[model samples]
Target chain A: MVRSKFFVSLISSLGIIALSVAWMPVPDAAAADPNTFNRLMKPPSKRNPPPTQDGIHDPGSIGTQGLQTPREAFKPLPPAQSGNYVDWVKAFDAKKIQPRFDSKDPKAKPVIMDLTIVRQVKGSMPDVIFPHKQHTEWLDCSNCHPVPFVPQKGANQMSMASIMLGESCGVCHGKVAFPVADCRRCHTETKGKATKTSAKAAAKPAKSKKK
Target chain B: MQATIHITKLRLLPVAMLLLVGSAAVRAEFGDIVLNNVSEQQGMRPVIFQHWFHRIRFQCRVCHNELKFEMRVGATQVTMDQISQGRFCGACHNGEIAWTVENCDLCHTGKPGLTTKIQGGHETKGPGIW
Candidate 1:
């Protein structure tokens, strides 16, 4: 009985480990479940989805004053706060323009624009204004060139699937390049529709409309 | 038998590469990019142009209006010869506006790439593998 119990415990422990990895978080490029990105990117548009806005958000986690979102309450290079990436993910900013580099290094060129990434197999890529000049400040040309980039296009199997899985641009964008969690920063629609409609209202609390 | 298989595989490799080098990567829905909608052509679609950084310098009108170029790839008809003359891309490729055309290798050297790096000064490793 003792031996069998030990074996059962071992198997159960392994099962828990696997399950936890599921929630541990997808790599920067690999992408977490879209429902999560949608929830984060799309304000609490409906009741089914949880609220991600500033005031009254995650009220269960805090009091009613409003959730302390960096993008909402804090702006301008983010105040000196003491929180992890979660704090950064929950915030949004309209003024802080996204950073990018003019890629003079041929090898650092990305495989595809985010607009056409295959959602079925590959996750959506953040439309990073990739900072080429900035990256060269630290990395070597061989790091991305020759090994990852081919001498021409379509030679590399770089897609959202590969990138998120850490193949192409995602190799760095997810791990180093400011991360892919900030949705609106990179995916800004030139023709403003949502923001023009709900700039401040997005941060306000939605009261229970009387039936 | 092993020797023959190895040689045969090696011989067919170039042909396979030729087909692959011609096509761009399968499309993605998002990222910093240039989109050119291929028009009037069947094999290659119009190039999707991305204004990732070009937007930093001149206004959209700089290229769209001042240059009188269309959004579509072939729509502008930037002949390899014309670029060398400062016509389409040549207008600025003279080391002042952009890279010099004498370095045809900059844009036209590689096999048809799905994408190309517009910036210069740093070393550029071609993105094609085929």
Candidate 2:
């Protein structure tokens, strides 16, 4: 009878151990293909993979061989901590990459707007400083206006939760531009101690051209 | 001896269950979308659309506005017939702007038996309670 009781306890303990192991948070790499996991959390070695190996293009395709690898292309660009590890804003400012403003008309120049929008957030987190100069360098105003963001200030209500759900700034920030992991990049303004640049920008009213 | 054998069999149950749960935890990275609306039925792999690559070349307005691609996944019924006629993907993929659709494997690179879904990285929601 004692042997049977010992076996029951052993089986129960083993079951508990198994349950705990199963419930333990699996590492992101273990859950999926490391290469195909979230790019934001990718190790430095896997950040800028080749065209064929990046999982976007077919490895067997002949065209994949001809395409340039991100590592080679981003060598001269400003380095970053996440995503493709290329600081696109710095690269644009430094003239390392001049993205065409208009796809159809190569000669068309972007209507550069030097503006900034400061969003005050609750809690100890720093306020957000949305810079139009950096964004307009590569994108047109229509890319964001009237869609994810309204032209007028305070017209759109935004929150971290909505952004995570792929709304508002998240439409691009976490997808094409940069992942939200780089929080300090946007939330740069401290409470009651606004930087000179942001303070000057906040003074000017947002100018929106009606179509 | 009999109790020992029974204990081993019972222990195997949780081990098997753990494996089952682990296999179900499939996930995808940010900007990756698995488009398999009609691929598997036609003996083709689902297309893995990478938003990062295309956005690097053209602005969001180019595809979202000019191409009229809905923001939601699987919202646009992209068909080969529409593509060949210079609509949707064919606008730039018609041998002049970008690669022609003749090379099928380039776009359709997703694993077999997957469905249309955005493989968005959930971690982008930021840490802690919002």
Candidate 3:
């Protein structure tokens, strides 16, 4: 009788061990990647925490600037009083907010240009209108001049793949600046006539405008 | 023999509990930093600076205060040109203290997608995990 009792207890003990092992928390799958875990331990506050409702994805933060994410990024933003990008640009122009400079130099005037050039990619999503004044408010002319883009017109070869890879406008758009998720932000030309005129202007051979 | 088995079984419970607690603490302790300033724009890989790798030997004040690195990501413009001149990371990585910039792949693993298979939880896998 004692032997049978002991046998039953042994089986129960083994079953408990098995159950505990199963209950153990599984390690993050990212932990399995060997190239990443150079050291056994890591420092705190380095990992990019999951986006919270009140985090960078907050709607108050989203405006004329690029939305952080397509889903949660758009929901939190305030309702637009004016649907037109031109009106928004006009409002900024009226305010007369000069270009921001890291260093104050009176001689270095901010380049205020009111030109909007539409770049149409045949059969792609709506053509994007390149806005100059909006960008000048935050960045210096040297930031994107001559390097990422040549001063001459149509010099930079911009594509969706390149932007996603963090090239061209993707450098600031997807990173700390703004994201390129909101297609409507750049494709503001809502009329069919404007699209055709810009398309024709671009296709005209050797009418390159010098900077 | 039965008493011995019972004691062993009782002991195992605490061990399992301790293990669960230990792992949870360790997983929460480590966090990774993604440094991408002009790297992607310049056709180079962004540097992923892991804190644990440096924390084991140095204190937080060394990099945070002494080195003048901002707590926020992308705030400090760490250019390769600056790094080569012994400014931020270049201070220690002057070939005397740590590995030099000549060993580019050690830190500049380009895009994280090309490096390691990143799982969910916003956790990424890249080079320099060693």
Candidate 4:
């Protein structure tokens, strides 16, 4: 009778210990039953693993103001911050251009193309003036000529939507080259332009064909 | 079950078509080159050449002009035997300048045997194993 009483006490003690353990901060149970157990109980080491060499470190943990930091709060380059409208253009022009050497043809002279393309994109924005001379000075003509933007005008329909989706001008612009955020850089002319209405006129034929 | 299978196939069709269209419109990015000749048959991943890494150090004309690397993919026939004998990619990657063929993962990108340095289990003393 005494042994039986001792056995009952031992079982009760084990039950109480198990209940206490369950009630206590159990990280394993927290992972298994996240809804019931608090996630804070998870060990710091397991919750936040040490960043691998190749893996990008968390910006929030690195003391950077997480997502709320304004881009304009940071100081831009001197040329970018300049009040003068033609500061970047003037600066680019002022710099002495280097001649590109071709290994295949030693005598090949660098062909400097100075042409301007004025594309009218309806009322969404002003006409985009593309300066060929500026781009050609840095890059080869083959970089964009035959493929992305055909040499022939009206061959390709370049829209703002397409550019935003990394097509045509977007292949270089907003990537390796200067970004498309600076409005005044491309759209220099603030004056109202005459409308050709060629986009609508071109669309009518396709629409009629579909009908 | 038949209806579910049909619906799944119908859902998959657009994704497959998009993949096809996406692959068809492959423009030459700075560091993107797909080389798949004998690699797939020999149980190896195709080589993905990084043009950007090479271009930063050397001009475009250096490889295209001097090395005679063809413009199109699979235009130049480069064998492992030829490579070891100082031909094609081996011109620079002959252990003297760039990383040799023993470091397969550098060109192979992601592969099953990426952990080990030498490829195909056994290392060939000479080009006789080709």
| Candidate number achieving the greatest DockQ relative to the actual structure | 2
Off by over 4 Å in 4: A1-110, A137-139, A164-167, A170-211, B1-41, B45-52, B58-105, B111-130
Q: What TM-score number comes out for model 2?
A: 0.68
Stretches of candidate 2 off by over 4 Å are: A1-42, A51-68, A140-142, A195-211, B1-30, B118-122, B125-130
RMSD of 3: 16.3
- The candidate that achieves the highest lDDT relative to the unseen native structure: 2
Kindly indicate the candidate among 2 and 4 with the higher lDDT: 2
lDDT of 4 by residue, B1-130 (tens): 6555545555555455545543332322222345656665667655645433453334443455456664334567777788888777777787766669886645654222222111211111111111
For model 4 chain B, where is the 10-residue window of minimal lDDT?
B120-129
- lDDT tens digits, residue span A1-211, model 1: 5455555555655565555455333445424555445444422221111122211122232221221222332234333222112222222122233322222232333222211111111234322223233334334444556756663434666554555544566544443233444444344332333234443332221111100
Worst 10 contiguous positions by lDDT, candidate 2 chain B: B121-130
Tens-place lDDT digits, model 1, residues B1-130? 6555545554455445444432322221111222222221323322322232243233333454446654222345555466666676666667875558665322321112333321111111122110
Give the clashing residue pairs of candidate 4, or none: none
For model 1 chain A, give the 10-residue run with minimal summed lDDT: A202-211
Which order, best to worst by DockQ?
2, 3, 4, 1
**Comparing 3 and 4 by DockQ, which wins?**
3
**lDDT sort, best first:** 2, 3, 4, 1
Shift in Å, residue A166, candidate 2: 2.1
lDDT (CA) per prediction? 0.35, 0.66, 0.47, 0.45
Better of 3 and 4 by lDDT: 3
Chain A TM-score across all models, in listed order: 0.30, 0.70, 0.46, 0.46
